[model samples]
Each structure stands twice: as C-alpha cells, then as structure tokens.
Target: MTRRSTGATTMPPAPTIPKIPPAEVLGRLAALQTLPTPALKEMWRQLFGREPLIFNRPYLQSRLAYRIQELAYGGLKPETRARLEALGEQLDGGNVVLRRIRADSRPLPGTRLVREYDGIQHVVTVRADDFEFEGRPYRSLSAIARHITGTRWNGWTFFGLKGRPEA
Candidate 1:
C-alpha cells in the first residue's frame, strides 16, 4: 500500500514581546509621544490586542503609557477597582445615562424590593435585564419610582440598593 501527502498546514508563531527593564519603562513611555499617530495606533493594537474605542491621540497616548507601565509593573488592585466602582456609583447619582454607561450594579434576578409610599406598600421584582412592578415591565427602577411618586428619583436609592447621595 502507498500513501500520498497533499500538504501540511502550520500556524504562525505568536508575536513575542521583548522584556523592558522597569527603569527603561519610563523612557519607553516618553518615546510614545514622539511616534506618529499610525505608529501609536499600531503600538496600541500590539499592546492591547484590540482597537481602541476612541481614536483621539491624547487618549491613546495616555492609555498606552499607562499600559506600558502596567505591563512592567502591574495593573490596579482588585480593591482599587472595587473602590473606583463604588466612587463611580456615588458620583453617578443614579443618573440613567450614567448608569447605562458604567458597570451594571443591578441586583440578582428574582430579588424583591419592597417600599411604602403614601401609606401603600409597593413591590418590585428584579429580572435579569429589567424589572417587574405592579405586574408590568419597567426598564429602570427610576421609572417605576417616578410612576409611584410622580417625581424623578434614583432607582438604586429608591429600592434601597444604595443610600441617597449626600447633598
């Protein structure tokens, strides 16, 4: 019996990143400012492994500079990330636009929130994406709160998920 080989396929090697000494990291960061926009974008692609959300040079340079240092050192700690999220929420003031932009702080589905307004008890059931109030679907707790109180409100505070922002 005889066998014939058609072809052999091989994957390309992954790009190897050269190690930069911690002290040289500062120089590398400074050099980023001198590179052209296209070069900077290519560097961003190489470092981040994805296209930047924004094409602004200053934004790219700042992020790339941080990434360079982060690679040599380390990124933010878990506690730092948590603290930033908390601060973001605090500053967000339950603004719907800001809420949509930042992290999702919604509670788990199947949770029930009870609040009394005008001497009547209101119940809201949390869903995966939206909420159910008075047997109707609502997009945000603020919307439900408005329906109940006839005024604007921060949904998280309204549901006791978060306390009212300090004045």
Candidate 2:
C-alpha cells in the first residue's frame, strides 16, 4: 500500500512462521516419548530456555512435544489467552489461592434448597455469604443439618449438594 503523506509503498507484515511439513512435526513428537530423562530435560531447556520445574518424565515429554508442535505451527492467539485469563478471574475472583482449589458448589443467591426430614419439608435459602433456614441465618448447611438431626454431618452431602461417601 502507498502512504499518502510519504508517497512510499510498503508491504504488509509477513507470516510469523513458515508452514512446516506434517511428517517432520509428527516424527519429532513421536521421538519425545522414547528420549531418556536427561535428553528430555536438555531438550526442555533448549526449547523453553529454562530448567524444568517439575522434572516428571511424562510431564517433560508432553511439554516438549507441545513446544515442538507450537514452534512448527503456532501458539494460542492473544484473544484466546485474554479470554482464558478473564474466565480464571471470574471463577476465582482474582484470588491466586482460590484458583488452585476446587470450585465450591454453593448455589446462586435466592436459590431455595428443599429437603424432607421426618415427613416435614425443610427449606433453606442460599444467600451471597450465608444461608437462611426457617427465617434464621446459618453460617453453614452443616450447622442447619446438626440442628435438624442433632448430629454432625457433612453439609454438602446432607443437603444433596454433593454425592455421599461410599462404604
């Protein structure tokens, strides 16, 4: 395209990577699994420019294979990475510690939990940070379960939010 100000023509940017042969990529991927631990670690250092943190054989192999393919082909798009980061933030509220933990099974606020105990129905309303059972606030479902059954129980299992443990 020609620039109006400078009256000079310029070419568009070239592709970041050249297309690689499928067979070459496949051969490199297949070779990763057969490599010894030392060779794999060396390849990891060469590809990633850093020492492998985990040092697990399978992890090294898989990551090496992925790096090979990524170099041959391409990596994730910027938009995809941004979307993944946004999703992680939403799931953990940007808390690093919470991100490593499993997501809790708390129902959305205003959800009504219904359970029948001794032929009488019980209802618990889920709030943002607490629960309401019989118009009274409860810190945990287990507390409400203990109040009903007079015994300690897993709140999630008691209210059927989670599966019961097998004997």
Tens digits of per-residue lDDT, candidate 2, 1-167, equal: 97577666787854343344666898888888788899998887777767789889989988888888888778899999999989889867888666654345566668888888899899999887788998899999899999888999887788888863211
Which portions of model 2 miss their true places by more than 4 Å? 1-22, 103-167
TM-scores of the models, in the order given: 0.45, 0.51
In model 2, pairs of residues that clash are: none
Query: Candidate 1, residue 127: CA error in Å?
Result: 33
* Cα misplacement distance, residue 113 of candidate 2 (Å): 16
Candidate 1, 49-158: lDDT as tens digits? 77778889999999989888888888899999999778766757747576654445666569899999899999999886789998999998899999999999988888
Q: Which parts of model 1 have CA positions greater than 4 angstroms off?
A: 1-20, 93-96, 99-167
